[model samples]
Target: MFWFQEGLCCLPTFLVVWSSSTFIVNYLIALFRRDVDVVFPYISDTGASPPESCIFGLMSTITAFAGFATMFARYKYLQRLNEITGGVSPALNKAALFFAITSCVGMCFVATFQETAIRIVHDIGAFIFFLSGVVYIILQTIISHKAHPYGTSKRVCYIRTIFAVVAFLAAFPTIICAFFVKETRLHWNPEDKEYTPHLASAVSEWIVSFTFVFFFFTYIQEFKQFTLKVNTELLEFK
Candidate 1:
């Protein structure tokens, strides 16, 4: 059972652990180096400087690749399930896959372009990641509902719907409040006028990131029931 899809959980688990660890490590490093505020810094803020930035870039790149694998596996799994169930929404599945892939590409951009280096490009990447990621989960929730109690369970569908809703709730504020802050300061003071908006946006970003990790965690159980297979055919040359 080498191809037993239960092992697919490792990809998401790796993503969750690796990304979370990357955040925590960078946060501590930036805090200790006095490179960022003690209160709360944007994840990118923690990775803006030298030593920590190196770690952040390397880890985030790997995280992005892992994300790609996880999404592709899920896409193939659903496609196979739909075939077996005679489902009518292949287009929906394809749409979900597209958004997921696009989000991963955004993650690469986030990793490559530091906010301090090219602020606009970095922000564009973050925007794409958050927006596409939220849409992907929402679409997946819809797909789960469409699958019903046959291909998937009511409980799983409800859980995914909740995660999707939470992600949307968080992502909106993360993007909106970010625009209100006029300056990007590594060390933020509580009394600063932009502090409130900055805090709101940073907190929202963390919430969205953690929600994405948990949402991927939910895929573990569902993945256990299936298997992935690749077939090769040799053709005669004329």
Candidate 2:
């Protein structure tokens, strides 16, 4: 009980600190750049210039953290379920583990390249994450359908199909955002002889936003399915 409480407490603290640090770093970048009007892009309702880092940073951070947290919690949950159920589906368990590992690696990349061209790599990593998830679901669906023609509920099968569909759809926006977002180019303005922030054009903002929404839905769907499966099994045993 105490360990669970400690783990829960650490989760929020990690989220807050990481989020605050990212925001402050972005704020500093904005302060130093004369050409960049705002740190974030979408916050300007009054034609105000976008911030140096948009709310996407915050959203991404939250999403990534939530992904990692869900992965962690689900790992333990699945392990315990496997033990209770005389070993849960190995394929499903392995898929969850792979997702968790790749998600963490993606998070590290994002954090490490917050303000550099390397951030583009993070987008590529994200695309891979989506693709991997889609593939995993498709494989799971095929295997489940074959192994348990009538053992698993139709609802479970439907959920897996939905996961693959959504993930594939989401991958497109992520790819667009990765390719379209302008890289920040450092330039010396001859007039002032000072370095300036030449932000990439604003076209990619919508792509980024759409990708966030898509991934958020993906996470919610997976989490819901996992929770439902656990609950159903527990109730059946009871």
Candidate 3:
């Protein structure tokens, strides 16, 4: 019980580090194997092939669940605060939870369905994941700013708001630049017409991914300031 309470504060850090490493390590693997070029590639592109694909799938599955747990923890924390202060309605927190869960579901799809193998499913998943994730963070920022004395400092809210803005800004270009690319490939020549657009899209995606990590990183200290308890009662019949 002591360990559980103590370790709960590290949930945000674990999510940030694990997910960031998942992307970086996969990129390095793909590069080392010559499966992908040194140039920026879509996050999915790095994990679309053999060994890296296997690692990507497994690690990404874990990342998705970790992300969901972090979000759910935040939701529950906010709900408890609302119960005490009555600052925001339960519905707002529920909406944030809904989007966070939806984003994780999308992440699961991205993990299970490799982009090179199932482009349509992968694309759909990417769409859902980024779109829902942006909404989740935006809602979270609002709640953080509005929730009174929830141990959320103004600086934390500002940091979240900045990352939320970056995610929103990067999301549009990730989709728009992809439209400009004629084809999707792991390696691209500088001379190819699709190269620039693909690079733009890829870079934008990396920015958005980093923004998520940064936003979650902000939660670490705030989470440490509070403790949560779960109670379960079993019914007994005589």
Model 3 residue 184 CA deviation in Å: 2.9
lDDT of 1 by residue, 93-142 (tens): 89999999889889889989999999889999999999999999999899
lDDT of 3 at 189: 91
Worst 10 residues of 3 by lDDT: 1-10
Clashing pairs in 1: none
Give the C-alpha lDDT of model 1.
Answer: 0.87
Best by lDDT: 3
TM-score of candidate 3 versus the correct structure, residues matched by position: 0.93
**Winner by TM-score:** 3
Q: Which stretches of candidate 3 lie over 4 Å from their true place?
A: 1-7, 235-238
Lowest summed lDDT across 10 adjacent residues in model 2 is found at 193-202
Residue 102, candidate 3: Cα error in Å is 0.6
TM-score of every candidate = 0.92, 0.45, 0.93
| Candidate 3 lDDT over residue span 54-110, tens digit each | 999999999999999899998888887888888877999999999999999999999
Which lDDT tens digits does candidate 2 get at residues 32-75? 65433443332111111235435435545565766567556555
lDDT for residue 202 in candidate 1, whole number 0-100: 95
**Poorest stretch of ten by lDDT in candidate 1:** 1-10
TM-score winner between candidates 2 and 3: 3
